[model samples]
Target: MEHREPGYVADKAQLLKRLRRAEGQVRGLQRMVEDDVYCIDVLTQVSAATKALETVALQLLDDHLAHCVAEASAEGGPVAEEKLREASAAIARLVRS
Candidate 1:
């Protein structure tokens, strides 16, 4: 059977909003570069954009853990273990980034 990722479906609107905002920030960054903006100012904007994206990632992770992982854990056995492992791997990748 196929499993649905609840977080994405549940937070679909909010997630899309966040992603769109980040995409706008990226476009602004490109404009700044094209306009020959100061290095430090551009760097600051880049940092802000990165943080915004990271916040979205963290929020999604929290939702996944609370909804997906929690439900899977309650189910028990292989599926539960797989979900936990997937979450752990996601966390590791996030931390490394």
Candidate 2:
């Protein structure tokens, strides 16, 4: 199969920015643990980091549905079925997380 640009290509920069911020949050979390910061404070930061990642995930999922899945569906064949299944699995994983 030919390689295609990801559905998130247009928003790649924004995605990277969010990911970097999340990375920082994680690093901060590590520092907090090492410094013996209050437990509640660490948990709050953890929630924030999780929320940031969830936002990124939702954006990517929307892009996939709008671009990859939509394009495959238009073609209407095994590719479309595969995309649909892949998307469903992704959604399930996100929900479980």
Candidate 3:
């Protein structure tokens, strides 16, 4: 198989930034728990962190659909089928999460 740059390569820096922010949010959540912060406040932070990660996931999915899937689809063979299946599985996982 040919190795290609990932769909997210173009936005790698931005993606990393978002991931770091999410990481910080998680750390904050840990601090909140350790400090015995209010339950609702902790929950709110959890929601924010979840949303941040979701946004990143959605962007990644969009990029994969636009680049990897599109390229594979144009080839129209087993690779295309595999990409589609992989994408479907990813979407299902995201939805379940």
Clashing pairs in 2: none
Single out the weakest 10-residue window by summed lDDT for candidate 2. Answer: 1-10
Clashes of each: 0, 0, 0
Q: Identify the candidate with maximal TM-score.
A: 2
> For residues 1-97, what per-residue lDDT tens digits would candidate 1 score against the true structure?
3868576687889988999999999999999999999999999999999998998999899999999899889999998999999999999999999
> Which lDDT values do the candidates have, in the order given?
0.92, 0.98, 0.97
Please give, for residues 26-53, the per-residue lDDT of candidate 2 as tens digits: 9999999999999999999999999999
What TM-score would each prediction reach against the true structure? 0.92, 0.98, 0.98
In Å, residue 42's CA in model 3 sits off its true spot by 0.3
Stronger candidate by TM-score (2 vs 3): 2
**Weakest 10 consecutive residues of candidate 3 by summed lDDT:** 1-10
Descending-lDDT candidate ranking: 2, 3, 1
lDDT of 2 at 49: 100
Q: Identify the runs in model 2 with alpha carbons over 4 angstroms from their true place.
A: none
